[model samples]
Target: MRHLMASAALAALVAGTAAAETPKDQLIVAFNMNNVLTMDPAAITGGEAVQILNNVYDALLQFDDEGRNLEPRLAEAWEIAPDNMSVTFHLRPDMEFASGNPVTAEDVAWSFKRTLTLNLAQASGLKSRGYSAENADEMFVAADPQTFVLNLPEPGDPKMILMYLTQAGIGSILDSKLVMEHDDGGDMGQGWLTNNSAGSGAFSLQQWRSNEYVLMTRNDEFWGEAPAMKRVLMRHLPESQSQRLGLEQGDLDVGLSLAASDLKALEADDDITVKTETSAGFYYLAASAADEKYANPKVREALRYLIDYKGINAAIMPYFGVERQRVVNSKAFGALSDPGYALDVDKAKALLAEAGYPDGFDTSIRVISTQEFLDSATAIQGTLAQAGINAEIITGDGGQIYGAMRAREFELLVGRGGGGQQPHPDSNLRALVYNPDNAQEAGLTNYQGWRTSFFDPELNGLIEEALVEPDQAKQTEMYETIQQMIDEKVIPIQPFSERVVTAAFQDNVQGLMVDPWTTRFEGVTKGE
Candidate 1:
């Protein structure tokens, strides 16, 4: 009976392998995520959702594989007005959305208006300079169906405004007719088009099985070079172990969010190819400044000193790319770096003493329930413990934890920030740290109620100046000052991690380009 059982198990494994290796026609990419809220290009914000959406939609402009700005899908040529407040785009007249409807300036205007409205409603986490609801209504006046004009309130900096439009969350243009036709009237809300996309992108969704798989086929009517692959199969494998196993067993051509430990072993395999890029993002701890104990600057500084970033990076991600002192890209927009605080246990202790907590304080570190974040929080807990700080680690669902952070439910929390292509420091500060309006219930990225009078005024001034300044020299100087200010004050501590690490079977995959600013799928192709 034991021999028979062993034989049966072996045969079962073989059968699974045969099924997994069925064909190269469907490009199965596994990701550690559950069912996404919506696949609509505009409404999608989470990491996994973006990955799936990129496969279906194309933006107005695209970032090259090297992270540089490039033109590909929608607009053919663009010119900025002499005063700098306006931009004119000549659209590609032949393009059409997945619905077979022509892509026009009206669609672009409608999409911009929807984003502006969503931003005003605080329903979506979209940010753009000179493109708010009020201005979008006035600024984006369509002169004709194929010609688009943007009139800025003030003479705006074209590059910065361009940066805003390129954000993956807002760049996708939706068909106005489809959106109006599909309003669901609930939390997913009156935008059927938000959950379902109709755009002039590279691929179109053929089938989506909730929590199971999403299948996409190349858009033969694409304006540019048609992809060589036939289909893209995205499987939701929420378990990290399962995703890793799928990659190893040749069942999945690509796997995302693989465990840090699994990366080393995967890199050793000759059949698989691995690539990683320094994410323009950071992992950091958010302490509730509203909390009585943490409101003290001394307490915050003490916690900063206690963190052993070097030790944590070495243990957690040995192949970690960068070690950030302040927030990632702290030097981007003229923010100052704080030279006073460094890794010093004794200094942390002394600061704790100065803060009226000589015995050290006990607090909880809240984190989203994910294996990757949990591992990172556990390492931090140990590091802080060594400094005499008692950190109780708590894990909960991501939505619940996000709400808790907003409600100031925990003393400290582990979170990440800066996931856009805009390399400017002002962009990061305004969206994540300085702007208080962003903390409103409707705002998307501002979970932590971080505000300081000094930083707030400074950021506002920078934005005002950046909008009008066309001189590259002056813009660079202003951004440097911004970075210097933020870094010196220790507003946020930036830790580093490999941003993009994806592997796929080399045999059938080609044009697998990853964009640093946003995940893109324009060039990806599967075997013919």
Candidate 2:
């Protein structure tokens, strides 16, 4: 406590002294630096990277601030084949990159093909949807300088295809000329793009320091309306207390990832505005299907009842997230109402007994060391103990914990997954539940279905069926049925919260978006 006070005092002194040098047209944001793993859209992961890249890159389509409504961006309009197997994007003419290079269809094609060739974080999304690297060039054709065509070899909805492209990684367009000029070795400029940006958005990457800060300068040659801020600074402050202090002392213009307590406190402060918007992700507890301990459907169902959803949402997830049982976000189509099942330890014990573990069994729970996740896990642990279940908490960073889950090495994991990358129900369904083949040779390890080793041929068929269904009402009906099946069968994963990214910024800082997907420094201005 004493050390914190001293640090706070020093920060106040520094902030006061630095105020004179800082420009009113510049914004300084402090958030957890650890959230951004990479800037290269092809390799980017997590919301932090998505939020940063949204400002630095432009996509064919984007979600507007209020509605997750899809709107044309780089592409002025599009044409979808009657068969729904192909879609062509008509690029806006006279588009210019930060480097003043004219945006072309070839650049957009290369940007997408680059994602497939590199096979980084984004390849799986397209690959699963049926675009292969071997045929990428053929899949993406630059019909002309202002026209790009995307041909889907698989049987999937072109609407979903367009929706997937709305995300920062898969949907982002790049400047082919600028990126190729910096290509080192055969990495397709992966090394260069890791620190630099070759995009046509409102800003350009000025500098980035891992676990430190990233600075961006306005792009004078930007194709659209310029941002109010001349520069934006994002500092990596992992500790909530530090971020709160920074926001309070005017050392930071915006503070991200503050704890619930701090957010409540900030809500009372007249100088700060605490905004919470629904994020594209969820908090879930997954169990490996390969483990016999959870093999029985009854066991998985019991685990669901064991979770104290109300207690956790009220005590732990407030401001950060809210109770969300279904895998699909409430904001998506075909979303079901919450089952409204409260915690019942007796019911959980009975289910466990039916699964042949009346006394319950010892298990391990893996969770990231973040406050919300850790607290939720701890609360669940105590609840499980009440049902005679002994759960050992294994905590680590996101990579360490999620890596274990991805490798199919975890028994149980409490972590965040299921990005509603697109507003379509298929978007969330394909990610959290769809599994085609579970064989080791398939190498579909990136999917949450594979990570949890959860596979059901019937469920798989249902997902594919729903995707191809064209009738709006029919499509949603099939999706609702699929969701019902998942709930009844006790799928290996249970979601407790639909995460909402919260940030406290200066009351004077206007136009700061609370949604990570739509977040950008554009139009942001400070008061006098």
Best by TM-score: 2
Please give, for residues 490-521, the per-residue lDDT of candidate 1 as tens digits. Answer: 45333433233444444456666543246655
Q: What local lDDT does model 1 show for residue 510?
A: 66
Worst 10 residues of 1 by lDDT: 447-456
lDDT for 455 (candidate 2): 90
Deviation from native of the Cα of residue 292 in model 2, angstroms: 4.0
Q: Which ranges of candidate 2 are over 4 A from the true structure?
A: 1-17, 20-22, 35-39, 183-195, 209-211, 291-293, 353-362, 396-411, 438-444
Q: Write the per-residue lDDT of candidate 2 for residues 56-86, one digit (tens) a residue.
A: 9999888777645778889999988888778
In angstroms, the error of model 1 at 39 is: 4.0
